[model samples]
Target: MDSLSYLNKYFLRYKKKLALGVLFILISNIAQVFIPIFLREGIDGIQQEVQYDKLFEYGLLIFVAAIIAGVFRFLIRQTIIVVSREIEYDLRQDFWAHIQKLSHRYFQNNSTGNIMAHATNDISAVRMYVGPAVMYSIDTVSKFIIIIAIMITISPLLTFYTLIPLPFLSYFVYQLSKKIHKKFTLIQESFSDLTTRAQENFAGIRVIKSYVREDGEIKNFTEQSEDYLNKTMDKVKIQALFQPILYTIAGLSVIIVVWAGGGMVIENLLTLGDISAFVIFLGMLIWPMIAFGWILNIIQQASASMKRLIKILHEELEIQDSKATRTIINSIKGRIEFKNVSFRYKNDLPDILDNISFSIEPGETIAIIGKTGSGKTTLLNLIPRLFDATNGDVLIDGYKIKEIPLKILRQNVGLVPQETFLFSDTLKNNILYGTKNGNDELVNHVAKISQLDKDVEGFPKGYETMLGERGITLSGGQKQRSCLARALAIDPKILILDDSFSSVDTNTEEEILKQLKEYMKDRTSIIVSHRISTVKDADKILVLHNGRIQEQGNHDELVSLGGIYADLHFKQLLEEELKELS
Candidate 1:
């Protein structure tokens, strides 16, 4: 119930349409109530004396009333149901926008399938409440009030007797509704799990095929499907009782009306027409009674879904521009400095990077070399503020990194991470992804610089070649080079390449590096790689060991030092000689 309060703003936004819908409900119900009156008059007039013209008048009046009611009923749906769809659109947009603003940590904690379930099933459930549940609630209330008032006008005693069973119906619905809400929450959770299983299976289909675990995966999915079916059956069993019990209660009221009103007619206290109208009014009340139960079912499901949505909407954004951010500092010259910075993903875990202090001048190319699990990538991530440092400060262009707006800071820095990801798009569009005004000229330039132009030219459609999902059509080295071209297309002032050349052969790697040497002459460049050949010619080299810099110098000086860098260099040289002999 509290979670449903989140929709108050949307209600206010569409209040005018809701008000018009209410007005239409009143008008429709008023017209519908008059049908019984005309029937009563016609029945009494026929008993008194047979007059064809009078009977025709009554029939015509009844027909007009029915037509009026039907028209307003259509108008009611036009206003109320239409507003529901509009609100659903707005809510979905808000959900998508909020998800985009959430930090990387949120994605790590949640699954893609769970989020997709929220976007599809959960949102549609809430829409049922916003549209159908709300519309029917008003319709049932207004119809009940109108029908009951007319019934009381016909005979106060009969109306009072028929309504005696209604209080019991209310109590029965209340108890079942509570159970329904709980069961619905469980069902929604199970649905999320089921959706996640299917999503993971699809995304990892290649892995399953590689391991030949199709039978095992199929068995697991079958188990999940059975679990979901059982939960749904449990909920359906509860709902199955709703209509039968509702009809039984409504039938009880009708019996009381017939028995009580028939006795009055026999005693000359009421006419035959009055008894007929009483029966008709009771029949109308049955629909409202059934609608009440259905509305409760929808409301319970919507409440459960809204609770799930609200939890995600309330997730705190870990990273955003703060009040201290400098709005005027729109660009940076790419002088990066790390002052005793240490970072850990969580406070309970050991630091991935510890006491890392380094500085890069505006136009120098600095290379970082370390074994796997060292903090080479983490150190570079701090420059672009991917993950904030746990202690100390990182400054860019002599300004604290946090002080710069994320948009401006990231726009000036181009990074090609170790894991290359490309969209299923045309080769030209993939290269031009982040640049707003990028033209063919810019795409061609970066492609040539990154040695991707040759591969694009070899394709049947050249730059227009459409890639498969995650660029699956390209070879490993082609994907890496394509990612490099994307980064270069942004025309960034600072370039960070995290092992971007691991897949390319030595000859191609040398060619790309030669091209980069001229392209990166004035831009600050940071390279993280395991290849000694890649970092040996940089202006300065930093060798990391166990989350700290072990050595810092040029290639010649590091070789003279006879330390970790020298040992790695010597090993790589021996491997190259062995490869040549082989």
Candidate 2:
């Protein structure tokens, strides 16, 4: 659907207010038209040496008309402008809510700054057109129609002369509208680029400082700013010509009316009072004409902004439940299976997991050990359906995950990724991020199991301590533990820890694992780690190499087999011995 159709629905939601606003505009314009009639009577009375009381009455009538017009104008703004603000609020909130539901892949393709521009600049532009532009456009048209009808009754020939130049103005404005829309669209695109550059620089400021590339980044940013300025100037150039052309045509119309009407007055074809009122009415028409040009500019800019917003809103949701697969399971058994699953992020990319298969029964602890690029983390992500396999099926409790509702499947699974993310909120809030109804007892229990309780004890406010952006105030191990506590707070049936313990010391790791074993007794646990010690005691160990499972067994069995798992264990043992000798 077009922007107009979408906006029409929003407008209809406030139809009563809009109708009232239009009525007030009509009243205001009618009152304004009466002012010219009062001027005509007052001039004719003064010419005839009329009594002072007669002139006073004419003056009073004009004053009353002006006051009524002003009051109605105020009402028009209160109704229409307020409704536009309400619609803008609804649109922006819905935009943000829709953005939150989009998949991780969507974010991977679109930058944060680009999306932010849509919410801020684009929304603001749309509001400008919807509110003031719409209000004034209606006001202008109503005023123009009223004044033109009055002038025609006074003298059709004079009115025709005044209106002859209007068709030219209309043609010029139509041409300018198209140009303005194109230029404005380009300007918005350049603005997006500028915003993206600034956002990247701010987010990567630490990297810039570490690499001593601050000057280079600033230079690059300046170049982007220059490009934005140039595009803005281009748009300004088009707009600069708009008003002058409109005024020129309006001026020609006035000149024609004055010259032709003056001759009529001299030849006794028209009275001086009639010509006086006609000029006043013609003068009133100029504002509406000029306002029409301004309205067109606003509309063109809004159209460009709306088009961008609609593009993102219309994007296909790549990761949503199908119509027939909206089951909300009451409980999850935590049994997981990868049935010959092969996967890649994109069709052209190499398969991260090739024809891989594995199964973990409920209440089993499975450790996955693999090299850096062996799809260890990717495999864990599939369990929660963060990304679906390109081929084959991943099932939980003998049911394909795609058939299960996303909320039900994800709610039962807890994932602690290697790259932990913590919001800039209190430690307590971060720990209970994904859970509902987080109580003190649950928070403390999960923190203790994740070895975060001891750290919280030393904090200034315990669990209430506020964190900096991405939890920058906390150490790496503390952040990881905090995230682990968060996942545990949800009381998930399936827990997948993807190198979650890398930052903690071995003693702390052992302490956490000791507590976790009891937690895993009734839940399914999958640990992906590079450290052999981290997963040595798991019920089953699967060693992956180059996107395929190289071996699978208990620690002692894998050691006896003398494969990749055995080789990794022996190497880690040698490293520990060397460290001891040192």
Per-candidate local distance difference test = 0.89, 0.87
Per-residue error at 4 for model 1, in Å?
2.8
Task: Give the residue spans of candidate 1 off by over 4 A.
Answer: 167-199, 232-242, 470-472
Worst lDDT run of 10 residues, candidate 2, spans 1-10
lDDT tens per residue, model 1, 335-361: 989899999988899999989888999
Number of clashes found in candidate 2: 0
Query: So what's the TM-score on candidate 2?
Result: 0.91
Model 1: lDDT equals: 0.89
User: Number of clashes in model 1?
Assistant: 0
lDDT of 2 by residue, 110-180 (tens): 87777877899889989988898899899888887788888888898998888787767767876787687
Clashing pairs for model 2 are none
- Residue 314, candidate 2: Cα error in Å is 3.4
Q: Identify the runs in model 2 with alpha carbons over 4 angstroms from their true place.
A: 1-3, 167-199, 225-250, 300-307, 326-328, 470-472
User: Among all windows of ten consecutive residues in candidate 1, which has the lowest summed lDDT?
Assistant: 285-294
